[model samples]
Target: MESKIILITGATNGIGKAAAKELAKQGHTVIVHGRNKDKTLRVLEEIKAETGNANIDILLGDLFLLSDVKKMADDVKKKYQKLDVLINNAGGTMGKVREATDEGFEKTIVLNLLSPFLLTQSLLPLLSNAPSARIINVSSEMHKFGGKPFFHDFQLEKNYDSVRAYGLSKLYLIWISRHLSAELKPKNITVNTVHPGVSNTNFGLDADRGFFTNLVGKLLMRFSLTAEQGAASLIYLASSDDVEHVTGLYYGPKKKPAEPSDRYYSIENENRVWGYCSQIVAPYMDT
Candidate 1:
């Protein structure tokens, strides 16, 4: 494989970190994102030492804030002339109650959806500079469990549940992937989403949880896939030749094209959600 400039969001831990190591091992320039300056640097150095690839770099941002996402994008644009691939992998679940970021957007929606939307839109020019660019979104199979999004209330303001919020966010991400795939077709940019399976990573441990819930989550982590294993599908979608031309699709276990829930297939919902996201991120995105 040829060396490429790849940026992965939320790469300080779990599947994102694992994917960064694997890609760097392949001799690609891997730019990883983390929320903390120190942790990001540590992960960056670790990947470099492990892969013997000094090209590894880091970017820090709190995905929940659109401003941070834009700043990160601007930094990338100024530093890299071309971005061969972008992996929107930074996301997590919130607690039982609703939590809003300082920006007023729900934490789950902003981190899992809006951040990627704004980042990708802002960096389209850099992606377009490459011969063929790929956008791999990290979604979840659990999306089916999180009932369809309340299109009217996209924020879950009326009734909020942790599982529901997480599922809706993932589902909406897949929908956005499909919608954007069409939008970028003329540019030869492939956009696809993947389910990393259930990984035994510190995924939701950071969220506030009750004693029982926390215990259950810890015990359940033992039975899931290792972080490296969970990143397999992500690696496939990000660099595989078989999927070079494939877009607007979801890949799950076995790295096969899987169908999302029926709710994600609704054209009406897709258009509405796409327009809504565009409007929300317009101020942060370039004209």
Candidate 2:
């Protein structure tokens, strides 16, 4: 396989880190995104030493803030002319208490959905420059059980639970992925989402989602997949030839196509979500 330039968010730890190392081992130029500069550089060095591939780089940005996301995208455009694969792998659950960023948007939605949407839009030019680009979004199976689409209340201003917020964000991410796949097909960019399975990462462990929820999360971790195991599907989507032309499909940990729940799906709702995200990130689009 030919070399490609790949950027993965939240690559400082967990599944993102695992995926970055594997991709670098495959001789790709891997750009790892992280919020903490020190930790990110440390992980970059670790991956280089372990993979014996020095083509790895790092970019820093907070995914919870759209302005930061835009700046990060600008940094990428300034440094690299083309991007082959972009993995939107940076996302997490919040605490039980509902919180908003300094930009005044809900935390979960911004991190998991809106920021990735904006970042992808901002980097479209770079992605289009590649021969055949891929956009891999890391969604979750929780979208099936935990998502409760209150279309009128996307930000969950009224009823907000951490798990529900995460589920809705992942669900909406799938919707936008499908929407973008069609929009970017002519540009040679294939967009898809994946469920990494229940990984034994620090995913929901730090979140204070109340005593009961936390306990259940811990119990489930005992039987969860390893970070590398969880990242298998992501690695496949990023580099495999089997899915080179596949777009707008959801893949499971088995590295095969899987159906995403469409219980709350409709053309109207999908368009609404897209429009809502575009409006929220409009100010950052040009800058």
The true-versus-predicted C-alpha distance at residue 83 of model 1, in Å, is 0.4
lDDT of the structure predicted as candidate 2: 0.94
Q: Write the per-residue lDDT of candidate 2 for residues 40-76, one digit (tens) a residue.
A: 9999999999999989999999998998999999999
- lDDT by residue for model 1 (88-173), tens: 99999888779998889999989998999999999999999999999999999878978857888888888688888888889889
TM-score of each: 0.96, 0.98
Model 2 error, position 268 (Å) = 0.8
Q: Which whole-number lDDT from 0 to 100 does residue 44 have in model 1? A: 90
The TM-score of predicted model 2 comes to 0.98
Clashes of 2: 0
